[model samples]
Target chain A: MKKNILEISSFSNEKLKYISGLKEKKNREKSGTFFIEGFREIQRAQISGKVKFEYILTCPDCYLGENEEDLVSSIDAKTILVPKQIFEKISYRDRPDGLIATAELPDFSLSSKTKLSDDPILVIEGVEKPGNLGTILRTAEGAGFHKVFVADPRLDLFNPNVIRSSTGTLFTLDVFQSDIKELYPILKNAGYKTFAVTPEAKSLHWDADLKGKVALVFGSEQYGLSEYARSQSDQYISLPMKGVADSLNLAMSAGILMYEVLRQKSQIDN
Target chain B: MKKNILEISSFSNEKLKYISGLKEKKNREKSGTFFIEGFREIQRAQISGKVKFEYILTCPDCYLGENEEDLVSSIDAKTILVPKQIFEKISYRDRPDGLIATAELPDFSLSSKTKLSDDPILVIEGVEKPGNLGTILRTAEGAGFHKVFVADPRLDLFNPNVIRSSTGTLFTLDVFQSDIKELYPILKNAGYKTFAVTPEAKSLHWDADLKGKVALVFGSEQYGLSEYARSQSDQYISLPMKGVADSLNLAMSAGILMYEVLRQKSQIDN
Candidate 1:
């Protein structure tokens, strides 16, 4: 590991202010950086080659864990040692393991991920909840979907809550943010069929043909797919709701659809 | 509407203290009551008959909304109008809709719900996250599963987070907490087949016959089903994971499986 060039205590108000400001999307955008915490998450971000770490901060007292020596040494980023109190102030988790890093946001373009996969692309529109967004990304990566496009995202992908919930899968997945109006033409031009998820849709997802190059579009839990999304969809489908609850959480809905896409692809491959 | 025996101000320290104490599980259990916030949630709890409201606290300045008058008038519980400051102090939500209530925890004995349904029963073992627990309940309800048994729940069902995340679906569903050791015999005696979800399981959930009386068992995300749960299960099944992630979130896994069970049942019905 690089020898620490900076030692920070909780009393360093200037540094604390700058670090805390990263919590907001605008501040992160202005600085072109975001925070990553926990050893596993930081390592995943680094290994993905998407994130460029500016600084890795750790509390020597309780930060390092088993096999973390090699993980720490592999980082080319500047290393800093901070007191436990300073780390706690910047950490988001209830019981933080003390490793935190600030990294430049990944520059993902739809053009870069064009040839990434032949399977369906997951698209989320007007997603408001950061936790839901993060969980969808984690599920997308786990389902082996290479490209996920967030159309009209209410929360930035780099928000600490999103990063934490994705468990660093955010860096591994090829995620791009664009307006649905802008994305619709691109997906159509790329010969993709879009299936919009809505509660009112008569088509059950299982009955609909999910095979081939597809884009599974879902809207925020509060509002089903936006009018623009519905207008562009090749077909409208829904996961059947049988009981009293009106709708499923966005993440669960997206997860079920992504896995269905994966399951269909596996069947074809076999 | 209750013509107010007590009007509370933020400065009423004793009243504030009692309401605030309901935030903790121990306090809720000691006094046998829990907090419910938001007009929609409180209304649902009242209508379900499962949750008994002890008191209804509304901030007159901002509490009443369109149609809320009818909802409020319907509640037979004691009503108290509190100052905005006092309402804000006990409100868990950031945008408090100015409605809060203290409700008696429903006595959800397994015996009371024994005749509830012959449909699949969702069993969650060692669930720790309130959000996950709540979401699963919401999903279980949406999928039309009548009864859910939590075996070794880490968080109490009446925790504010669970109440909030379930979107008050907790009141509508037949939920009970029981030990895994105690629950196995009960399920078996009822002619329900217990299918434990685990990563190492050989059977794919889809291939398994999920037709008649079934109990779908899921464990905490951290640790799969306990040895006791596995031992008591009739068959062990898993949701196919084809990506780098080892497992799905507890809620999502439960949702997919519950829906799968619903799908099979629908197929048989047709």
Candidate 2:
């Protein structure tokens, strides 16, 4: 809610060029910054205090709902007020709430989340879809898993779809990319058993001894767990696929497993 | 494989006009037939033999994988071969597999799925998104629930998104629409315990006794189970939302609860 306001109506503006360039993954990697488009999402990222914002873009005319200005006022960042047409051109959402914040990508390193949970260490490998990745983070957060490690990510962690699908839970959770090969040794050193979810596995998730510290590993929906992922596991677990479903979507698979982990922990606690 | 192939290339063709017009919800409603685009999905619908196919449109050059011709040859219906451009124009997929089948909407009434399972009855109510509906059908099938009763559906059963997201499992299950009011009485008469899922519900799904004949009821993601859905339910149950997640996605919610029902049954079976 700083007093210094910068208005950029021209599409060719330098700051506008940099903002639109962020839609590309290469630019995000180069800048080490990503944009969160909704006021609710931006507020979540701001509240987490993990990310440092450079600026916020607002189009008061294009806003869909309440208190968007309040969010703009709350965050200590340069504010850009553009016309509705200029704002819509930059917006990714169908019904945007007219606030977008650009923030420095915080560390998703597994090191940032050590000692966060005694529950299952949730690690996702070679995730190809941003929606799945985002949904996984949301599911992990919802199930009370503190940190989710992304190993060999095919998509960027801050893909707008990931932010949207996670409903801004991305900021609340410790989600970072690490190599799957490197991840297992650390998990093992930390006295954790690793369970890779694969369709080939004979073990049902229900039968697995998740009462102890464990890591639930998953691969892309297109490819089940990698050969390395399967080989490194302490056990192989699977959900039942009875009729026509070849496999569950990655996020759905993660949800079922995370809740199973939660359920087992609740049994112990109660 | 039946070989009744009728080739049509012109976009202005009368039959092609009908196929493209079905893209509109109004056209689909007027004709009482919906189009499912994808080779795998058409094959499932053909194999299910529950709905009568009106015709199929295919473009061999546009197919991404094998067996397009085999599917066209198997179904005993009129086939029209078009160029890649015509197929792409009608396809909702980013990567089209070049098969679109038109079929009359099948009966979605609970009576249609009668005697399908002694397992927990699966009932989805007031679902707004086609993707969620499709995923719910896939989850029900995977968890070994034979029939999925979609009550008061907000979207058509055979929406392209539903067909695609379900991975063609829509054809393999008994999916039908009926009012929520009508569903429970029939379920009650059939000795099924109806558990409506809502966030306001005090009982957790894990703690709920689901061993007996039961029905898991779900509402739209935006609005939890409707008042009729909640009040009519024998008990209201909720999935845990530990972090910032307001609620689980409709499909993910269904997946967790269906698996929970499956887990309890597995215990008794052992």
Candidate 3:
């Protein structure tokens, strides 16, 4: 251990207050850092090798095994010990495991000229809920989409809730934010076929040709895609609604569409 | 109006306290009543004719349209006008629409001998989250499964969160709660094949026969279908996960499978 151990027992500690400030998107953006919580998510983020940790804080009482010790020692990041009460105060979860970290935001950007594989790319528009955004990211990774562009996201992509709900899959994928207006041309120039998922579409989602360099687009829970997203797409598709519900949740819709893309691609491969 | 307009200006009002107490599952069950929030959900519940409203509380400051007035007038239940501050205390949402209600639990029970359509039936075993339960119910309804049996649910079907998240679809569908052991024999005796969705199952979900009377079974997020559910299923199926995520969200998996059942059945219909 580096012997720079900063003990924080009081809620009045400036560093503790600063760490708590990371909960807001404005603070995170200003600091160019985001927070990650829980054992599984932090471990996954560490293993992904994409996160550049600035600080790791742990409560001594919550330590489980040698594995956690090894994890703490392996990283070059500054490690701090926090009292259990202090940890609880900073935690968003009702029962936290007492491991938390701050890391620089993922180093990536959305550009018109960016190259993509022949596999499908996900484009989510105006996804307001962090939980929904995180679930969509997890589903995207599971369905083998290498890149997802979030257009006009209402929630910060690196919000702690998003990171937690994603099970840290957010670190494992190429997620970029670009407005739909700017993104349309980039996809078009890349020779990608864009499909917008909407309730009003006549083409059933599975019926849409989701093969070979396709872009599957989705929208928010309260509102479907904006006019720009709807009008710019090459094709419009919808999931079948045989009963009373007019739509599925945004994350559910994205997951279904991503898998459909996978299913079609797999069928073609076979 | 019967002019019984009971004013609850104080949060300490016994009835207000009682209404607030319904937030707990035990209290809801003990009182033989549950809470419903917002104008749209309350309206849907009322229009379904399945909900027996005991009281309708509205804040004059939040009333929207002639529709709200019409809806309040149409119900035979006792109506009360609560001050906005008191309404805020009883409201679950931050931005209260100014309408809330208490209603008697729907009169229904699960039995092995209950009638079901020839179409597929959905059985969710031990779903822990109220949100997931609601999403599954909404998806189940959208996919045309007229009835769903939640086997040993962790939360009540009529929980406010479940009711809200389902977009009030709970009132439109036939939902029941029973154990997997009990549900199995009922489906088997009803000439319905039981398909349990599991991560370990080798058979791809799409390749399975989803036609005729089939009970598609799922498990909770924490513990996927119990051992009894696994052992008793007529067939085991899994959604193809092509990348790093070990599994999708419970609701996402359920939604994808439900839609697949619809797609396959629709193909046969065509």
Docking class of 3: medium
Task: Give me the candidate number with maximum lDDT.
Answer: 3
How would you encode candidate 1's per-residue C-alpha lDDT over A186-256 as one tens digit per residue?
88877899999888889988888899989999998667688898888999998888776668889998888
Q: Which residue window of length 10 is worst by lDDT in model 3 chain A?
A: A62-71
The parts of candidate 2 lying over 4 Å away from their true place are A7-14, A61-66, A83-86, A109-117, B9-14, B62-66, B110-117
lDDT of 1 by residue, B78-155 (tens): 777778877887889887888888878788655534663578999999999999998998888888987899888887
The 10-residue segment with the lowest total lDDT in model 3 chain B: B1-10
Candidate 2 TM-score versus the reference: 0.93
Instruction: Write the residue-wise lDDT of candidate 2 on A1-270 in tens digits.
Output: 356899899999999888877877888999998888887789889888898998899999988777888888988888999998888888887777789888888877766345535557799999989988888888888898877888988888889999988888888887767889878888888788999888777989998878768789999867767889888888988998888655788889889999999999889889
Off by over 4 Å in 3: A1-7, A63-66, B1-7, B64-66
lDDT (10s digit) by residue, model 3, range B1-270 = 544667768888888888888877899989999899888788878878989988888897977655787778777777888888888888898678888889998865786457866878999999889999888888887888888888888777878889888878788788877877777888887789999999988999988888788889999898898989988889999988776667889998998898888888888899
Q: What local distance difference test score does each model get? A: 0.82, 0.84, 0.84
DockQ (model 3, Cα) = 0.77
Give residue A192's error in model 2 in angstroms.
1.3
Task: After the best TM-score superposition of candidate 2, give how far the Cα of residue A58 lies from its true spot, in angstroms.
Answer: 2.3
**What's the lDDT for candidate 1?**
0.82
Candidate 3 local lDDT, A1-270, one digit each (tens): 543767778889887787788989999999999888877788888888989998888886876544776677776678888988889899878778778888888865676556777778999999889999999988888888989998898878889989988988887777788888888888898899999999999999877778898998888877879989888899999988888667888898888888888888988899
